[model samples]
Structures are given as structure tokens and as C-alpha cells.
Target: MINRAEGAYLGAVRAFQNPMLDLLHKRHAPLVVSVLSACFTAERPNVSVADAHTQIGDALDQLRAAGYDESLPIGTSRDLCRQWADAGWLMRQVVDDVEVYRLSAHAVDALDVAGRAGGARARVSQSRVRTMLDAVERLAQDADPDALVRMARLDAEIRRLQQELDRIQRTGAVEEVDDEQLLEEAENLLHLARELPADFARVAESIKSMQRDVVTALRQDERPTGEVLREYLERAQHVMEATSEGRAFAGALRLIGDPQRLDGLSNQLDVVLRHRFTGRLAPQQRTELREIGHRIEQGLDLVFTTQREASYVITAQVRNHDPLRDRQVDDLLRDVMTGLQTWMPESRRGQSVDPLRRLPVAEVDHLRQTAGDLRPAQPPAPLEDRDDAVVDVTSDEARAWGGPHYAELDRHLVTLADGRSIVDVAVAFNAAPEALRRPVDLLGLLELADNQGMEETDELAFVDAVRPDGTRRRLAFGGVTTRMKEAVDE
Candidate 1:
């Protein structure tokens, strides 16, 4: 027979691995996956069977438009819904005499995975580094109860900052990142932003589960009320405090609620969006990001509500039994006994104890000396006299290299006949008055092909062009037709 440990291990592994993943990967299941993704990935609380069916049909249509010819019958969609309900990916309930589906915990986890997998790959960025540093500082302060431990961490951070400053001074300045690097970092930020909501949702679900377990235990357990309350309180504290995931979840909730952090995150995202190297996001990505943000906010609110409800329930239960009050009395007696044990002898009681005597004096002195030695030295003063001289340029000289004035070219091109080839326009431009034929004016003519109303035709023509330097250049002009308005008779 298999051992209990082996069985437990297998069970844990099974719980971690979603069977729906295999079903999603099966052939002919792409449409089903898309339907589930669209329906569950959204922030809606529930979807009726009719609505889900309609959504599936719409998804199938989209798939067909995207060149997938496989036909999905209505029966197949219904069967898929039934399968998901059976597999625990969806919970079905009758609402207003109509069946509706809400995503099960497994479904939510599956969707979270799908979202991250489909999103842009995350990259390390300066903002993320700063956030990490802030988290480390906060954790050090919160997790370490000893004052000396906190002092040591703070000292180390200070030294690290000093070293960074020294490195920057030696290097003159930080180098600018190239476009490729910026794009990678932006994509990474987007990935993390998308995942944030999903993470919050999972945390909220865990809290809800804990709440449910507490309620169930209170209702079903036959133990003494005080003992049960104590057990529940201990478990709740352990889940919300002792565990790393719990701590992280709590930290994330606090960060989410922090206005300054929210503003900083918003500013960072705005910068990423406005970056020259960051191209336009796909429609789906934009939608996903917006949905993620909305869902995260909603999930956080729900978590707070659940917590309040749990607290209310616990308070009511404790009040009914008065166990906590009795327990407090017991704790008081225990504390009194512990204090008696710690009471000094009559001879020693008269002597005053120094708080400093608690610490290792030699170690403290060594730390002080080491900290003094690690302090950064002051920089040398600059030279009194410098050979560099500043030069000023006249306005005309500055304007000379400004390159290309395109207003005249734009006005002339916009008034041209609808079907005129770019070659014909070029000839007309060349034959125009000298005042309109300035190199800067012709520069605007080249930009017409890129204009909004300009449509390229199959024909191509070679044209002679004059550069801003007055040099002759051969240019290939793709025949383009401009949309010109017809004059209406008065």
C-alpha cells in the first residue's frame, strides 16, 4: 500500500496541476479556450447560459474571420459548458429560472495563467528596482523586532547608496538606454501591470476561503467555544502574518491603497506609454490592461468587505461565549506568576540596572568604528581658472540650419487636382515661382505621400528633386491620388 506521505504529495501535485489545461490544449478546443478567456478574463461577476452561448458564437465568428474554417455547432458550445461545469472550471446556478455560470477558483487560476502567458515578457526596470528597494526597507523595519538589526540594515543601505553615488561621479553620468532596451523594459512593465490584478484576485479568493473555513468550523465543531475561538484566531493570524505569501498579499493591499504609490505607478505607466520607442499597443492588450486594473480595484474592495464580515462574525461569536474575557483573566494570572519568577533577590533589587548593559558593548563599539570607516570621503574642490569659453550664435545663424519650411508646399498640394501623379506635381512644383520654389517649401512636397488623404496607386514615376543643399537627387514617386473636395455652386 502507498504511504500517507506519498499520497499527500500526489494530492498536492494534483491540486497544483489543473486538468482543464490539458482539455484546453486538446485539438479543436481553440474556440472553446477563446470563449472561456473572453468571458472569464472580463470583470463581470457572472454570465448567463444564453449570454455565454452568444459570446461563444461571436468568438467562433471571430475565429472564422481570422482564417480558421472549423465549424462550431450550438450543441458543441452547450456540451463544452456542461463539461466545464462538471470539471469544476465553472459553477452553475439557477438565477431567475435561467442557468448562469460563475468562474470557479480553478477557472480563475487558469485564466490568470493564460493572461500572463499571452502578455508581453516582463523586463527589469529602474522603477521595479526602486520598488524592490522600498519593499526591502519596509520588510526590514517590520520583520525585525530588534533595534540593532534595523540599524544594521539602515547602515548597509546607506553605504550602498554612497557607493552608487561614487560610481556615478566616476562615470560622469548614467548612459542613456537605446530604443531596444526601452522597448523591452516597457513591455516588462506592461506584463507586470497586467499580472497585478490577477495576483490581487487570488489573494482575495484566499481570504474568502479562510473566512468560509472559519464560519464552517464555528458551525460544525463540538469543542469548547473558547478553545474554538482561540484556534480560529491563531489560524487567522498565522495565515495573515506568519506566512511569506500572506505577508506579500498584505503588503500589496497596503501599496494598492497608498495614494503616493498609486500616483507614482500611474506616472511610470504614463511615461512608458508616451515613450518614443514604445509602439502602439494592440487593441486586446489595451483592453486586458484596463480590465486588469478594474478587476484589481474591485477585488481589493471585496477583500476588505470579506475581512470586515469575518471580523463581525468572530466578534459576535466571542461575545456570545465570553471566552476571550475569561482567557484574558487567565493570561493576567500567568503574567503575574512569570513576573514573580523574574523578581530580583532583595540584595540585588536595590541596585539599578542599565539598559545599555543588555547589549554586547564590544560588538556595539566595533560596529560604530566600522560604520565610521565606511563613511564616504569629501570630494576635492574644482580649479579656480578654466580654459573653456562659451560662444553665442545670432538668431539668423540658428534659423539657417532649421531645415525645411513646408507650409507653402502643404497649401499647394492640398489644392491640387484629385488624380495628379506625384511626378506631375513635382514638375509643377519645379516650374512654380521662385518665391514658392524655395528648398524649404519643396521639402513639404515630399511629405504629401505620407499625408492622410493621399492614396497610393499601382503606377510609379521617377522625378528630379532638389535637396535643401541645392543638389540634384533622383526620387521615386509612387503615384498617389489626393481626395479633393468639389466646389459647390452658390
Candidate 2:
């Protein structure tokens, strides 16, 4: 319908050649279109031609060709001429006793534009029809002789599409066009299968798979590679299950043991998988694809649960590194990430996770982004400010302690450089394997007043505790080791 409307408008917009003009001469369209066309061109006045021609212009000849005899039905050529004059498509005048009907500039301009665009639209429409017909020809060659009927059907479809294009051109718009080329392409391939000998049919079955695949590939927006495989396998199985007794590719798959062909298809699959998966799949998900346990057990035959008859023999041949296969792994990773979000406790984890430390970059970024604790606090500004103060020092503790937290008696355990126990150094250190027994010993303190060696400090400078929080707090580290000995001797 849209195409029809467009075609109608397109015809109205352009000027017609002799044949087309003949078609439109007495039609109702010329009255309106002639005026609109006039609005588009420069005017020419006082132009005269010889009376031996016995006519005004080519437009008059068109009406005459359309049987402008006095015997016509509703109105004869005279009556129609009067109508055109009234409608402003033409003007009547006399000079030297010769009548000349001149085209209005409006009519001329509309005709010129309409003619250009209309011709262009016609050309494009013809091209599309040709393309569709080419596909039909291929289908005819491959399908059963009886399937020739399908070619005719496709031709009809092309004709319909051509008409539609014409209509759209007229209207200057095309919307909701269901013109997926693959749909017909698949049918064309299928036709070849139907016409081929059994030996060829075997290969044809595999090719027909292309048709089915096109339907899926375009429809799925975010479909994972593995899921696609799974879909293909299931589809094959369903088709096989629906019809029985024939051992074919769609039915038996054993016919596809041709090594070269298998390699080619497998390579294609590899390309698809590489594009879709890559490192995109996470470790856990990757692990899942490697697991043969989840798949139905088969000896020697490897099945891509997705592709029908899409299986291979487990020889020394290399495994297919299809990005698509990795999609399963990728999806599983997303699921794990989302699941951990709700239940997992905060710790150090990341692309480089120290299971012992539990710090993840994503989690860290989340903390940085989130507003500090909004809950009521002892001081009222929200205790979340304090949350930033606490560090998961175990992350640094590993540099300090060398291994997972060990009990103090284990002998290697040591305290922080401060008096605080190693266990107390980290935010969750209390819950860590509690193994610390003592704080680190302290040495005497001195100030480097300038670039000189150093400046001696008063005994008071080396206090048992120095305030880290700005306010005075008696947080101690260790007793003076050598300073006390010197002082005692003094």
C-alpha cells in the first residue's frame, strides 16, 4: 500500500514522455499534477510555432493518441481540453489567427522534476527485481524439478516488491520494510538440496543449515556463542526427531564425515567463536566449557550441542578455538559476578585476587564511588568517613608476613612496625588467622634538621606513643632498646 501511494505521487510529480502522457492525457491526475509542475519552472510567453504542425504541443498529441474522438464516453477531447485550461495546466491564446496552447511554468517544472525522480525510481525497482530473479534461478537449478514452482513464487514476490518500491518512490517514504535478503537466500540454497542426487543432498543438508542459521543470527541481540551452539544442536535434534528413518545430515549427520568439508565448517565456527568470546569469557566459565562431564558422553564423536550433525571425530586433530564456544564461559562469568554481588563479603579480590587477602578492583571502585556510610554515627557526620580510615592491611601484610597468617608460636609471626599486633594492622585482621604475639621494638628518634647528618633529639622527642590521629592518644609501640641503657649509665 505504501509503495502504491508513493508510485502514484511520483507519477504526479514528474513529466511524462509521449507514451506516458498518452496514458495520463484524459486521466484525472493531469489537472492537479499539471498545475503543481507549473509551480516549478520559468515562464515562457509570446513564443509561437508554425501552423503547419496543426497542434499546440506534444501534450495535445497525447490526448489525440488516447482516442480523443468525439465518440468518447464521459467527455470528449474538447471537454477535457476545457478542463485542463480551467485547471491551469494549460492556457489558451491566439496570435495571427493561429491557436497556441502554452504549458504553464508550474506544469513544466513539476514535469521535469517528476520525470527525473520517477525515472530513477523505475531503474532501481528494475534492479531489485533482477536481483530477486537471479536468486530464483539458482533455486531452480538446485531444487527438485517440481520445486520450479518455488521460482515462480519468488518471481511473484519480486514483482510485488517492485510494485512496492514504485509506490514508495511516489510517496517519498519507506517504512517497516520486511526485506531480509537472507530469508530468500536460505530458500534458494534449500532448493539446490531438493534437486540434487543423494550424494549431493548430503552436502546440501549442511548448506540448508545456513538458512536456519541466518534466522537465528539476526534475531538474537545478545545471544551468547555457546547458547547459539546449544540452539543449533537442539534444532538439529528436533528436526531429526520429527522425521525418522532417513540417515542424513539433518537426520543422521554421519554423512558429513568428509574431512575437508568438516575442517572448512569448523574453521567458520572458529571465526564466529573468536569474534563472540575471546577473553570475554571468565575463568570459571572457561572451566565449564572444558568440562566434558556436563555434555552427553560419546566416544570418538565430538558434538557441538548447538549445530545439528555438527560434530567431529576426536582424533589427534587440534581442538576448535571458536570464540563462540567461549560464550558459554563468558555468560557463566557474568552470572557468577552478579551472584557474588549480593552475598559475598567485602575483601580483597580483583583481576589479581589474593584469596588470602580478598581485594577486587571492581569492589574497590564501588567503595570509592559510593557515598560514605549514611547511617547515624556517634559524631553525626556519618561514621562512613571512618570506613575509609581502615585499611585491609593484610594486603600489605603479605609483604610484611610473607605467607597466610600463621599462629604466633609458629615462630615467624611478627608485629607491625607500630606496637599494634600484626592481626590488628588490617581492617579484618581480627578475623584473620590470629597469630601475632608482640609489637615491633622501637629505636631512639632523631630529627634531620637540615641536609646535615642529623640533629640530636631530646629524650622527650622519643615518647612511648605519638598521636597518628592529630589528637593525643597513648598508642604505644615498644620500650626504648639502647636509649635506656645509655641513660641508665649516665
Candidate 3:
């Protein structure tokens, strides 16, 4: 007794409320989609929470630099990620005991939509029509309850194939699909493949939901254990069959599960990439075609891993179901909630409680005792006098290993600056003793020049300095000129 038009209008409203549609229709849809596409890919579908913050923070900086300030969401990367998780565009879960952020099914769907929108439009071609025809025919043949109709359809298909084979054998020539048709079919296949990630994500999400339901049911203890166990068994067996998306994924898995089929797909993709017609395709398109098989494999692996983890968690919970413990924990939580409710009004009026940064230390009554000795068993021997050891005070090699003689250099510079208003640092450096002519000494001279407010000139100058190992080398640096003290006073 409902009007079809009103029902359709209400349905559209509900559909728009879906996370995927919300993502697509949001004001910052472009920003959200672009950021997600850059962050998550087939190669890296999940990012640790910390890494997500850093990468997205850097991405926002780049966007702002590229003039997207007005379009960017407010708050830090952590805030934005939390918001996205709350909005159902991102899934925040623990993977390998580490918190990570993964693109939700809704987010993946939005990305697929964005990717297709940015790519070349799918044209209405013979390849598309043929694909539709083939799908419809196969579906009819499979769905036909009458055996005669099915047999007749198969007979016609067999005869047509036989005719083509006979003609090919007679002419020794095979019909080649043109470049246009091949490209069309390749694009169509890629278009279908693009949805695999979203589909796989949905399946994983559904399994997680089932896990939550099973755990809740187990904890509630409202039903008998036998009934709950039976329901769980049935759900576990049909986890992949529980939803339409999961069923489609199961079918895909069956098709791709064969190693031989995957290998054949890889070989075909390689051959296609080598074809001259593929040159017309964009680089992204070509790369996607090459990776289609691997992408499907990764998606399947993710889903399987998710299923196993969910099953393990649920099974463990079932085995460890403690109704009394669960009830006690629920009571404690409710008590806490009641206290919070009582305190919230007071808090709103500025009565606040200091939040603990960490758990307090526990108090203990007694401590363990330990005894140690700082004194040695026997007294250590006194230091020996080495004044009788030979010494080489005048060895140039000894001085070479020591630091620069700053006092000697200062006196020498004063002597050089005596009637000259300006002194060139390189000339003074070259005239100094070998000990003062070490590279360290050259650096010392530059520091002195710099401290005297002498700016380096653009002209290049070279200084010959000896290394600690007795090797001499020439080094080039900017010309530095320092004025004498007398000149500065004048």
C-alpha cells in the first residue's frame, strides 16, 4: 500500500546516508580521495597509526603548499584520521598487536570511483556489447530449468564454435581482434578488477561484525551454550556465504584459486603489455594491467587472514566463556558509567578532576636486602713514577699531533699586521710554521678572521697546509681579508 515514488525517494535518501556516498558527496571529497589514494595502495593497504599521522601530516603540508589551504580539514593529522574513522571512511584496528589504519570499504569504493572518474571514459564498444551478450547467455543457460532448452543452447554454442574451427582449419588463418577492441576489453577488465579491493574489504568487515555478534552473544549468556555453539558453527561455515559481496568474492576466489589460472593470467598480461596497441594506454593503465593478478592475490590473502583471525578470536572466546566473570566486569563498567554520569554535570560547571598520565605505583611493606663491598679484598698498588721514561720535547712530529698554537699564531699575525692596513688570511697562512700550517690551524685563522668581522670575498684563494700525517695539500676557499686593529680604530 506504499506509493512507489515516495518509496524510491526515501530509498535514495537512505542511500545517500551510506558512508561511501557521504564520502563522494562531501565538500572535501576531492581532498579526502586524493589523500587516501596517495597514502594507501595495493602494495601497502594498512599503515600503522603513528606512520599514518606522519604521512598524512606531510601530505597535508604538501597540499597546503600547493594552494589547498581553504579546502583542507581543520586540526592535526591525528584528528583528521580519528574523524575519518568515526565517519566510517577509515578502519582503525589492531594488526599484529599494533594499531593501524586501513581504508574502509567505503573509502576504497570512493577511491575506485575517483580513479575511474580521472581515467579515460569507458566508451560504448563492440567489446562491451559482446561481454554483456556472453554473460546473459551463460546466465540463461545456467538458470533454465528445462533440460531441453539448456541442451539446445549448448548445441548451438558447440556448432558455432565448430564452424569457426572448421573455417580456421580450412583457411589456416585465425581472426585477430583489432587494437580498438583489445583496448576496450582490457579497460573493461581493469574496470572490474578495480572493485576487488572494496569487495574484499567488505568481506573482511562482515566477518569482523560476525565476530562481534558472536562474542556479544557469548558474553550475554542469555541463550544456552549449546544453542550459541550451534549458531556459531553455522555462521562460521557460511561466513563467506552470509552476504552477497562475500558470495561474489567466494566466486572470484574459486576462479583465481587455481595456480594454473593465475599463471596463465600473468602470461597473458605480459603478452598484452608487449603488444604495440598497448602503447596507446596510459602508464597507469599499463602498470595496472601488469599487476592485476598480484592485486587479486593480495586481496584474497587479506580476506583469508582476516577470516582466520576472526575465527580464532571467536573460538578462543567460546572456549573461555565465563558468564560470572563477564557479569562482574559489566557491573564494574556500569558503576563507572553511573559515577561519570553523576560527575558530568559538576564537570560542566568547571569542577574538574586531574587526569592520571600513568598508573600509580603500588605500595609495598617490605623490601629485599642485599650486601655488597666497595673495598677490594687486597689493597691496590700505588702508582709508579714514569719520570725516568725518555721524552722528546722538541720533536716536530710530536707537535703535529697536538692542537694549533693559538698564542703563537696570534703573535705572528700581530707582527704581520704591523704596517699593513689589511692582511690576506691565505698569505699569512702560507707563511706560518708547519705546525701552525696544519689544516686545523687554517680553520683557526678563518675563525679569528670571522670573529674580527671580516667578510669573505667572492674571489677564490688557495692555501697549502700539511696534514697530521705529514702530507701537504692545496685547498681553495673564499678570500678573507681582516683589517688591522689600528685601521679599525682609525
The predictions' CA RMSDs to the true structure, in order, are: 34.8, 31.6, 13.7
Q: For model 1, what is the alpha-carbon lDDT of residue 487?
A: 24
lDDT of 3 by residue, 352-458 (tens): 68887998798989886644877657777998889888668679767767776778887778788887778899999998877788888988888777766686778
| Model 1, span 88-151: residue lDDT tens | 6776655446778767655665665665666654556665676689779797689879988888
Tell how far residue 35 is off in model 3, in angstroms: 0.8
How far off is model 3, as Cα RMSD? 13.7
- Assess candidate 2 and give its lDDT: 0.40
Which numbered prediction scores highest in TM-score against the true structure? 3
> Least lDDT summed over 10 consecutive residues: which range in candidate 3?
368-377
Global CA lDDT of candidate 3, please? 0.86
TM-score of each: 0.46, 0.15, 0.68
Q: Tell me the whole-model lDDT of each prediction, alpha carbons only.
A: 0.62, 0.40, 0.86
The TM-score between candidate 3 and the true structure equals 0.68
Q: Please identify model 1 stretches exceeding 4 Å from their true place.
A: 1-29, 42-50, 57-79, 91-105, 115-175, 211-221, 224-230, 242-245, 280-295, 305-490
Per-residue lDDT value at 122 in model 2: 28
Taking the candidates one at a time, how many backbone clashes does each contain?
1, 38, 0
The stretch of ten residues in a row with the least summed lDDT in candidate 2 is 441-450
